[model samples]
Target: MQVELGQKIIDKIKADSLSPKPRWHFLVREWLVWMMGALALIVGAASVSVMRYLAENSSWAVQAPYGQTFAGWLLLSLPYFWLFLLGLFLWLFYYNLKHTKRGYRYPMIYVAGIALFGSILLGLAFYTLGVGSAIDGVLGRKAPLYAHVFNPHIDFWSAPEEGRLAGLVVAHVEGEDTFRLIDRKRGEWIVTYNPRDDIFVVVGQPLRAMGTISGEQSFEAVRIMRMRPGREYFQRFGPTVISVSGSGMHRNK
Candidate 1:
């Protein structure tokens, strides 16, 4: 019985070797999976780039009157839809990577780690290549609806009365609390600091002010802070400026 079984195995191997093999299908499938992973990585990287661009250009810091802690503003203005898309791509990459030839030999953690690491590395490359920016510009010009859907600055200046305004300090109004501010919307406004608060004002600085909008293009600042690009929102607020003087800086409020 053992000899017969051995003979059968040998016969089976010979038969398989002689048969017309469609094993090319396996190779094709493997390449297809790899392509899917590559595509996912590309898209994930693009989404990241667009998200960074939005954060850099966002005026959310200064547009809401109800004071937003950095954390609150981040929660409100984050490009969540793009982030969701990025997550979806990463998931697809993982799924595809897991199905490739010999992929099952690895543990799930290893599979996931490779996918994540590869995607991140590819993402950084895409960002440095400016692929994201190019894609963003194209989408904005060619697909208005799509661009609007993903646009990060849609509601940056939505409300004024709540002491939110984002803009560059163009000029200090001659040693006064008032400064000329060109807001994100290209609207100019007069911003006055509260007399009791001490803050340094700098020309050409990107800034956000929280206080009250008294009239058209006029704002009374409750708090002022320099705005930075690509910084994460934190729960803690920075120290408020106390005063600015040609003689020196003062922090006593």
Candidate 2:
């Protein structure tokens, strides 16, 4: 009875002209699954790196002017769209990894934790290497809608009445502590400064200032920040990573 049953199964397979798939077919599928997982991890890392760039470049030390706590600033500064991308790619990474040949042995939570942790680790490395700022520069210049969406920096400094101002140095006297500027909206400003700020300015360079609106079309700067077209950005303590290669108004002292 057992012999007859086995023979019938073999006959069915032969009659249907079915043949076993080649070994490489399954191998390729396995490799593809692993590749997809790795790609997802890399992209998730990029997303995290960008988020860190925004946070570190934000007005983290200048919350006094905004009247908000550190927690409040953190909540508001987070990029929800980027956060969503991070979560989405994490899921992709987890899903692809779990489909691998030996992946089924691992618990779901283990895979997910690895995905999250790996992304964060790689993201930190990317941040330290200035990849985040470089990506930000590309997006800021290439993506037209990015300015409209990421307008916090511009909006915050536009409020000259609240002791904040930013614009390009349109004119200035050589060796003088004052300059003329035009804002993003093309409005003119007369800005007086101090040399101790360490931010040497020249015509056509955009700058940020905080102090008081001195008078009609005039302003006084208690502190000033310089923005240039490079990878070197200023931190409150000193020069650090990040830059106006895609940002403005990043220092507080």
TM-scores of all candidate predictions against the true structure: 0.55, 0.77
Q: Across residues 133-199, which tens digit of lDDT does each residue of candidate 1 receive? A: 6666566535544423665444453245544666666656445678767664567788889654435
Worst 10 residues of 1 by lDDT: 230-239
Candidate 2: worst-modelled 10 consecutive residues by lDDT: 229-238
TM-score of 2: 0.77
In candidate 1, position 21 carries an lDDT of: 53
Backbone clashes in candidate 1 total 11
RMSD of 2: 7.8
Each model's number of backbone clashes? 11, 0
Q: Write the per-residue lDDT of candidate 2 for residues 66-98, one digit (tens) a residue.
A: 587888877666677678889999999999988
lDDT of each: 0.65, 0.72
lDDT (C-alpha) at residue 153 in model 2: 52
